[model samples]
Target: MTGPRIALFAEGGDWHAARLGESFAARGAALVRLSLDRAMLATGTETGVELPGFDDGLPDAVLVKTVAAGSFEAITLRLGILHALRDLGVPVWNDARAIERCVDKAATSFHLARAGLPTPATWTTEDREAACRIVARECGQGPLVLKPLFGSQGRGLLLVERPEDLPPPEATGGVHYLQRLVRSPAGLFEDYRLFVVAGRVVAAMARRGATWITNVKQGGEPLPFTPDARMTRLAVAAAGAVGADYCGVDLIRDEAGRALVLEVNSMPAWAGLQSVTPVDIAAAIADGLLAALPQRRQLAAAGG
Candidate 1:
């Protein structure tokens, strides 16, 4: 049996690409790490190289990561590339449209809230005065988490314990997404990143930190944790809400001892989850990708 060829995208993701590749390779699948960032634009040339450094041909699927904002032309060009890949019938992880929504914290929050899933109580306003007022009122004693409309890896998050402590509104387009802070136990300033692949929670683990932030990139430690039925259900629900077959749902316990989703990463990095949990998250991802392939369409069309 030949292995399914996988292409992992973007730069600085070589480690994860390697992890997933190794996981799939161990399972008899050939995984290829293609750093899309290697396709650098030159001073005058157009149509930068594709499939560089390898002669393995286009992949059966690709796991996308890292997107940089650029001028209108660049934005359109990048998006056109994504759409073109999907049009070519290659399976892209996090799915294509899912990437568009999950990258924006504000938009994802709105969509999750609309689906009646539990998310942090949030108020987004370009009106600085209004944003400040809400944070002042709702976050009286507990901390308030101020997030960039587009943030990841727990970066650009502000733990505004006081109203006067927040940055000036003009700093972030005069708008803010303020959520009521939820604190974990004293010993564990941790949260769970529920790994969902193919609408199921493949792995569940907690992160412990000294502060409210608990991302591995933020010096937090990943620890093993079990997913109760509630966590499983909600995590799956959150993924479905975001229209992603693969994602990481960030869950924190609220005052009521219930899990409340804080954020959903459409293109979630599973290095931590893979490390802590016994599940082969990469294989789950590969399985999901294979299941979503166009071959299913052909089989259905032929009445197989």
Candidate 2:
């Protein structure tokens, strides 16, 4: 008998997809690679959503590995496919709503703050004048970090020491997302990346670099580190704040030793974390996704 089929949404030649495929196979499941751009909505089909290679029916579950960069309409359509799948009773790991909240840094910050979580002071606006005022007022305390609202991997970051340092709106995708820069004591550049799965911190690493940006993709070195109880609690809370089934919670400490959440990534990459840890990150994620399957949950509830 064939095992449950899982649809993995990722681009071609993705290393993470390959790892997940292997992990799922080890657990008596088949992982079929699919692209979100190719997912279609058809009225006359058995499943209103027409995913490539799932001609007879929808996959047992959908795992969102990556959502490629595209125009606003294109991205919306891609997310719409995830939404459609969930409405069809197919489990979508980290579903559309969670993706949206984490993709937009402003939204993530809002949710974190609303939950009373300790996060960096942030302000996002489209009005250049208001942004300038925020910069002028906040810069006196320290430098403000200008980040692209819809970006990741430590890209497109700038330290704004003055209002004049603010770029034109056209250069910033028509929005200014600024946060007060949080630095470690004595100019140390380091932060923690905690991998949370099933409401627990399974593994973690310390990213250290010469500059303020400590992302592994940006030349930071990843080192194995066990998270303390406070870090574990903060990371789990950050993930819950954004409603993610699994996530990578970025945490850093201020000079006064208060832990602050830097960001919560819904669709985070774990290659660097995997390299330093022996927890089999990919298998953990596959386990988390499969355990959340609707059929599995129903069976468990029925004592199967």
Candidate 3:
């Protein structure tokens, strides 16, 4: 079989993109790395999609590494392009639907709960009074973690220890997403980031945080972790719940030592997780994506 051509969507010339390009090249797959901002979409075109340096045609599949922040319209258009590509029968690993669901914290929580996965109690509301009520109730029990509805890398996160410390809904960009803070019995702030690919846990690592937030981007240190059955099962289930072809599932253990799903990232970065784990994550991802191309073609042939 001919090697499948792949389109890697990310911020151009970044470390992750460059590394992925090298991995794909080593696997004998052609890769076209371009930003979503550069992919043109139109109504009257052959494929209705025009990516930079792909004058021949679209690739066999698309791998989304990063979807840059943009205005509402810009973001919508970029997602629309991915949607269009899927409608045209090209496989989009972690397609637009999964990306949209994972990007919205509220949606991710709902899906996890629907799949019977344990997640922190979360409340989101546009009404300031209603949001404040949630904060008061949660604070009465324990500290609350206020997070942006659409964010990652632990940015814009706030710990509401006191009811009076709660910010208004407007401060949360017109929506308050609060979760009950889960404490570790040992009083150490840590969590597990399990990287799942194609419904399997490819690699995992424990993150030790300087404070309550254990995200690597928040100054946490990554340590090698051998995932137990429970952790691996929960991570895989969470990824399936979010409809991700590949993802990073964050698992935090509460005071009772029972793990709870924290978040599922559809376009997860593996640099930190790679440092501690011996797994060549880039190669694994490349193999999974390449394997998917043949399966996609077979499905199309079978009218699936």
Per residue, candidate 2 scores C-alpha lDDT tens digits across 1-304 of 8888999999999999999999999999999998899999888977689999898899998888899989999998999989888777777877899999999999999999999999999999999999999999989999999999988999999999999999999989999999999998767899999999878888999999989999999999999999889999999999999988899999998998888999999999999999899999889988888777866457545654
Residue pairs in candidate 1 whose N, alpha carbon or C atoms collide under 3 angstroms? none
Q: Give the 10-residue window scoring lowest on summed lDDT in candidate 2.
A: 295-304
Better of 2 and 3 by lDDT: 2
Better of 1 and 2 by TM-score: 2
Ranking by lDDT: 2, 3, 1
CA-lDDT, candidates in order: 0.74, 0.92, 0.89
Compared with the true structure, the alpha-carbon lDDT of candidate 1 equals: 0.74
Q: Which stretches of candidate 1 lie above 4 Å from their native place? A: 1-4, 26-32, 35-59, 68-73, 185-188, 294-304
Reference-based TM-score of each model: 0.82, 0.95, 0.96
Ranked by TM-score, top first: 3, 2, 1
RMSD after CA superposition, every candidate: 4.4, 2.4, 1.4
Deviation (Å) of 295 in candidate 3: 1.1
**Best candidate, lDDT:** 2
